[model samples]
Target: MTTQLFVPKFRVDECLAQVKECLEKGWTGMGFKTVEIEDRWKEYTGLPHAHFLSSATAGLHLAFEVLKRKHGWQDGDEVISTSLTFVSTNHAIKYAGLTPVFADVDKYLCLDPEAILDKITTRTRAVVFVGLGGNTGQLDKVAQICKEKGIALVLDAAHMAGTRYRGKHIGYNADVTVFSFQAVKNMPTADSGMICFKEQSDDELARKLTWLGINKDTYARTAAQGAYKWKYDVEDLGFKYHGNSIMAGLALVSLKYLDNDNSYRRQISKWYRDELNGVEGIEIVPVAEGCESSTHLLQLRLERRDGLLVFLNEKGVYPGVHYTDNSEYEMYKDCGQCKNSVKASNEIISLPMHVGLSKNEVDKVSCLVKEFLKG
Candidate 1:
């Protein structure tokens, strides 16, 4: 069998170095490196505060819990969100006891801003915008509408680690932005996440909430000089959502090369635009103006998607699909608002995208895709 091109680039040695540090320190639960990662994240995004969590799903859940409590949200209060996202995104909203108001997407396959107006009602307490396909499409408009209507903006930025809007990071604008560092993301730390909050009490609250509602974290107690006493207060509700040191070490190393890695992925995306734009029955996604995507996904709308996928696989080019619609899932009932998302979901195909593929491999994949259409 011929070697297949893997979309994402990964290095065992890079991950191993961080793991080695954790082994040597022996305090590999959630202290030194986790704090370092949070500090570096603060430096990178310039957001007021950042907390490392177990996963982006955890981050999203924490964001919703914090916002819902702050806004006095009742059970089943509505939150406008996209159906064209990972199930975890919607699941987090549900975890907060809020109803998800499914919305349509625009050309960029992101949540439609205008559709948000129709979905909003008196009970609508927040807007959870997923940065679909790695692009922050019409995010500014969504934020503006949320602010004007006095609803919170909770960003499910799982795909937007390196994305920027008008020279500012997307995480900075939203009330709370959740980032994933899962194995396949732009910055993978096996499985870890970050919640970048806009301001103070929310940040402090999140920290406590993740660590079993304790007033002080393990780091504070461990790092103290005197007779290191364990004393704390139980405030709001909390959970065991805190991340450990080993993942944090991995994250710190991953951060160093994330930007450079994303740059290569972006270049591959541009190559797709240049090469496949001319192919018949192929519609490439449009990039929103003034926004820079992390290019986590390179999705295409094609006429013969199922057949094309089979053909690509036959030729040793294994493409993928980002998602199936959330409404299709039995647990989540259909809200029936997102025709565009459902349509795109049916036709969308995610081509190989990552730093792993070289220029020659990219050229070969593109050529094979073109050949599939001819045959």
Candidate 2:
């Protein structure tokens, strides 16, 4: 059997049942299930407020938009971000009409706090930190620094659905946090995400902003008994980025299995570490202290990453790269100067990680990697 990167496993019967509930009620857009998922997410993560969105990208864009509006930030204000992330992270910054100041990453492949300080300037408004592959490298320090510097912190926790820090779920400290429930994430939901805000006001504003700036959502309007059902006012310019009932239904089922699934992923990571540790040419990316990662990806740093990727493919095992440095892209070239990000981009490979892989399969992949290194 070929081992591939990121195969999402779903509970078909349960998922179908959730979908059936939505269908039977004749409510498949934006309301019923979406509300339930938001409430459940808050309870699960202990976040003050949660808003369901079409995707993490939308949530990220919304986060900045809400923050910018609330703080009265001017256009072209800067947001410090790591270059070692999906372009969505930086793209959202641009979508908010802000400048992205590329920063370096730490050993765990997360934004480096010290580098963040170096990037700070008078116009710097916020720091966007991505918890790459669920690792929370120096996030506590980063959060503290942001607070001390009087800047907002937005956590792009796209890969950290089940990650925890100091026994609490990640994102408790950030001004806002966005989590991806995209098909291949730890909590697969076709394509959806949750934006958690530390303040209830921001959550309320986000809810309004996601539904075309309507003061009252359709669900609430329909549930009301008066002539005011259709009397909502468009308070601000908003995007149609709210999540639908169908995706919310899928998210509910996946949330039930997320903890168990992540535990197994962690085990798979351990197996890889045990097999590859002390190998002369390989370096396992370490999870941050006090962080119980979701193990979204078991990444490794090695000199022969490209050659090993091809070798693994020939052996019916396919690995993948998490990202290329965002600064390397033409759109971001002017801001690209993070040496560590460029170096790590060349050396890192995200090995196959999913709920379906068995211990034997992990061993097989590891042995193949060792064989390539030996050659």
| Model 1, runs deviating above 4 Å | 1-8, 225-228
Task: Work out the TM-score per prediction.
Answer: 0.96, 0.99
Q: What lDDT score is found at residue 301 in candidate 2? A: 95
Of the candidates shown, which would achieve the greatest lDDT relative to the real structure?
2
- The pairs that clash in candidate 2 are none
Report lDDT per candidate: 0.86, 0.94
lDDT (Cα) of model 1? 0.86
lDDT of 1 by residue, 1-375 (tens): 332433345566877888898899788887888889999998887788899999999999999999988778999999998888899999999999989989889999988889999899999999999888679899899999998999999999898887888888777769999999998888887899999889788998899999989888887887767764576788867999989999998888888888898788889998888899968988988879987888888888987888888888887787888778888888666656478988888899988887877777778878877887887
List candidate 2 segments past 4 Å from native: none
